[model samples]
Target: MELSVTAVILTLTAILCLYYWNNRGRRSRLPPGPPALPLIGNSLHIDKRAPDRSLIQLGRKYGPVFTIWLGPRPAVVLCGYKAVKEALVDQADDFGARGTIPSISKVTNGYGIASSNGPRSRQLRSFAITALGHRGNGTSTLEGFVQQEAETLVEAFTKTQELPFDPTFRLTCATANIMCAVVFGCRFDHTDPKLLALLHMMDENMKVISSPWGQLYDLLPNLLDCLPGPHNRLFENANKIKSFLREMIQLHKDTHREGTPRDFIESFLAKMDEEKGNPRSEFNDENLLLSTFNIFLAGTDTTGSTMRWGLLIFLKYPEVQEKIQSEIDREIGMDRTPCMGDREKMPYTNAAIHEIQRYANIIPLNLPHTVTRDTEFRGFLIPKGMLVIPLLSSVLYDPSCWETPKSFNINHFLDERGQLKHKDAFLPFSIGNRMCIGEKVAEMQLFIFLTTLLQKFTFRSPVEPSAIDISPLSSGFSTLHHPYQLYCIPRRPARRPASE
Candidate 1:
């Protein structure tokens, strides 16, 4: 009897899935795409390991705006700068809501800023901007945090005796340490076991999420959740990381002051206390825990990964490294630390960082967005709550917008005059309302971190430069670098400041 019941349930599931798939694109006036199959929609069309590559291929055939199915759901994918800018920037109000990530949405449960929509997102966003420190108003508390971490990072590399070692671990620690100081008001010692374990979890989480397992889980979450797989490791690590955040939140609860907030956690806790009487406030324990987790996942990984990609590129082309290091030496000299102010004076270094961000596909398909209400975009009807993907790689690598979209060229971010020239399509942190909240902090961190290291050391790969493979090992949710070691030989520039 049990077997019969299970068979009956399975039959019903298949029938419903088939019914939904049969009418996939016909029901909605979403932009046209290739035909979808029964029960699977267009899952087979996507390369599970690297969905962005497949998506880019499809975009060429289907045009900038088109509909594709990820399992039973019909999503509108916006490709290229013009189409993406039209929806995300031109109609920011309709496309500002956050969409779901089924693979881990169960874990987050729509409580945090990254996963939440509407009122909660706005409230959290407003609070975050203020807490991250005032960027241009000269009250940049965040810059001090990043600069301190950058100095420590340089010292750590200097201790390696200029031997060849994988800089991934040290770089991760350096970037994560900045987040720790911003969030918790303290930085961890470079050799701390606690910090090491957290970084390991982060690294593992990235691997799983970028693998086929994570993509499959997102595509067919219902079926995959019942079965055991490598994607399970991602969930496990994410949860453990959340648990760590929870403990930290509890610790802050014991010592947090009301008006004198030291860090983001304290400021948030004080706000929660202020809003305790308000029934509709989004500032609660769960939001705090998940929001901080969102920061850890985002703030730590992107900066660290970009830096790693940078080293790989430099190893591949030592000449590029020479140009940036020369710029650093001439502009800042060896006596003073590099700051956000110096970024303007050193155009080549600034352009180098911009090109690295553009060339390294850090975030491929950016965070999913949703339609706030029934809307029309590029001659198609998009119903409220429909998932919309802004393909970031499409924009960053769009041929129309970039001179050498397929190549690693610093000239893309520079003009013939050798000054840093900003490109309209270069939206690495993304553009419009739902853009990354930590943009200012990240720019400061990357500039200071890169320049500070160059101030004290010159990087060289163990093998000859030409033998190094600059290609990424994997590209799914984001690009991942393979294991490579390098020498951070100490250096001091004797040249005088160029414009001083």
Candidate 2:
């Protein structure tokens, strides 16, 4: 019995020594990072509760590119424009794949473009771009869609009798309609239960994904899945969205055509049929369903949040708002509704819109991309499957890139002659091949809705400047603040016809 006990103790001692030796020297090879504790690593130092600020603090100490331990996983953070550009742009395809967090995998199921890599990712991305007609210079296909949605939005808002109103629910509805129009080839009224559930799911999923608890759950999903938490709630929400997408797919499948496609749903369904027999086809019902729902979540919130931010800024900076209003009046005139084409004529207004995107910086750290192959960036070794985050907020707010990154300066986008100048650093939509797929659609909506709203209503603060706290609260992966309401007061044009 003593012999057996001695053997067991020896084996335990040997295993512990091996584990210690394994982790001891591994830290030096990786990039500079914070001190870590046992089992948790640097997670103890990190405010996993507020990863963004925690990361920003770490970036200051460790330079732009640094490593942090997400439990046992090694996560490399790319901060500032230089580091982000190096990894995402200079070494584009090297970091084409997305790193799948345990929580994200549980939520997304490794199905959508946000989670996958390789040929499947490429195929889905290529197909989405083609289907949306987001190609080349001056594409009219997406512009037309934006214009239609803006008109419908105006009609809906007009129903409210020029009274003091909160634009949140309506604005979300209008923005969501455009998303729906793109994905399912339709729009939903704000009161629709199914649509409400989808939006809530999108919001909740984002919240859970960015939380500390969420991070822990992601790191240990196998064990966590058996227990109950916010992650589980997010998963349930994701499933509901999937179910909604399935219903929409069935509807599209029931009524689809070959050459004459009705909308995105019809077009995608047609593709599935055409590629049905192919062994390598990725156009199955499941992919189509997930991709469609992905659009609904991605397209709607980003644009809607942006518009909400734009109005808040307008209320804060009335002079700038007035300048935009004046430009809109001169370019599009008081009688007619503003369209996508009007964007060029109204240069100042366009610049202001662009500035709003830069100032808001909704996506502080963009969707994480995985290093697909071994690559070197700025003399640092980036191994395959490493999570590379491109901090877009760094680019938008880069001191070298912008003259005044902090100030809400429209002039940054305006040249000496006050015409719109597209700055290379102004990449709210992000850069390279794996950029936001619905970028064109988002731009179109921004131009149309921003211009249209300025023409119709002047956003004003309900109380004094001191009463307003413009600081943002955490929304999700995105940097949206508290739910502040705005008053949309109708503006009477300089020239009203006798009919009015």
| TM-score against truth, every candidate | 0.93, 0.90
Among all candidates shown, the one with the greatest TM-score: 1
- Clash counts per candidate, in order, are 0, 3
Q: Write the per-residue lDDT of candidate 2 for residues 400-425, one digit (tens) a residue.
A: 88998878898999999999998888
Lowest summed lDDT across 10 adjacent residues in model 1 is found at: 133-142
- Which tens-of-lDDT digit does each residue in 1-500 have in candidate 1? 99999999999888887876876555568788878875577988888766888898999999999889887778999999999999999999999998899965877899887888878988998898888756422346667778788888888898899888989999999999889977887888978988988999988888888898888888889999899988888888888888888889989998776577877889889899889999989999989998888877799999999998888888888898788888887788887888888888988888999999998879989999999998988778898888999999999999999988988999998888999998999999888988998887788888899888877887899999888877667788888877899999888656567895
lDDT leader: 1
Candidate 1 colliding pairs, count: 0
Clashing pairs in 2: 97-370, 472-481, 473-481
